[model samples]
Target: MDFKELLKELKGNLLSLMGSKFDELKDESKKDVQAFLNASKEKLERWTTLLAEGNITVSDYKWLVESQKDLVVLKGLYAAGVSKIKLGHLKNSILDTVIETAIGFVKPNKDDDNEATV
Candidate 1:
């Protein structure tokens, strides 16, 4: 899987994770999302390669994503009166989207144990 393409798709998926109705949320959170993508690009590349090579599981990906929680701050949303519960949901949604999108992009390259027959 192309890392650049994966990043692009992740950006779109995360920006729309709250659905179309939350336009304000989308607009307000775009910078935060970009910031995350920028800061996480290298780490994501490594983990994605691991994912594609069957070196890591979805659970591992979730754990790695969670480790970057500090990078997902949403000052704009907080200032916009978005409740803590909703903000938490959005943050969770972002992390969930990252894992889901990575899974969708990178298929495990595991080979069959048995040899092929003619």
Candidate 2:
């Protein structure tokens, strides 16, 4: 695929991941949710700055996608590690469903060819 297609896929994947993560937070205890929100806001600020600076190369984008996946796995592990934690299984499953839906929306359509080519 071309760069634009790759970017679309990446955006879709990121959105799906973020949506699921948000859904999971929604079912968390108020204190846990608040802490996660604070952390997410900080991380989002950094991501936005990086995006605005146009500092990411293709390799960097690849690394970012992989890192996000790793983070998801880490979160699952961390949740599992807790001895007496009340996990939100239903919310977590719904988050997984959201990711699947997001992935389904990533394909490019024919109308994308409207731009003038060099």
Candidate 3:
């Protein structure tokens, strides 16, 4: 898996999620992803390798991704007065994006039938 590319896609998808208002929290968008990286980088690398090597189920990978939910505070947006409900949804959405993008970059082993784990 190409981590750099995966990160790029994640940031792009995040910005897109913001639509035309993307610029509103430009630093937060960048920081959100950076925070995710700072917190999840090693784990993500290991997990992606396991995933690609057919060593873990996709569900397991997703769960592992979800475990890092605390890392993305989106504090700038929150401080900017985005509602708790909206921020909650946005947080979930960001996590979902991470899962999707990481999975997209992983070219799993052909034999991986989602029945494996380390």
Measured against the true structure, the TM-scores of the candidates, in listed sequence, are 0.81, 0.29, 0.78
For model 2, which pairs clash? none
Q: Which pairs of residues clash in candidate 1, taking residues 3 or more apart in a chain or in different chains?
A: none
Q: What are the per-residue Cα lDDT tens digits for candidate 1 across 25-66? A: 766778777888898899999998986776776667668887
Cα lDDT of all candidates, in order? 0.75, 0.36, 0.72
| TM match of model 3 to true structure | 0.78
* Candidate 2 TM-score over all chains jointly: 0.29
Write down the RMSD of all candidates, one decimal each: 5.9, 10.6, 3.6
Instruction: Give the per-residue lDDT of model 2 (tens digit) for 23-97.
Output: 454333333433433343344334434433445432343334334332232253245343323234533542343
Better of 1 and 3 by TM-score: 1
TM-score winner between candidates 2 and 3: 3
- Looking at candidate 1, what is the lDDT of residue 108? 35
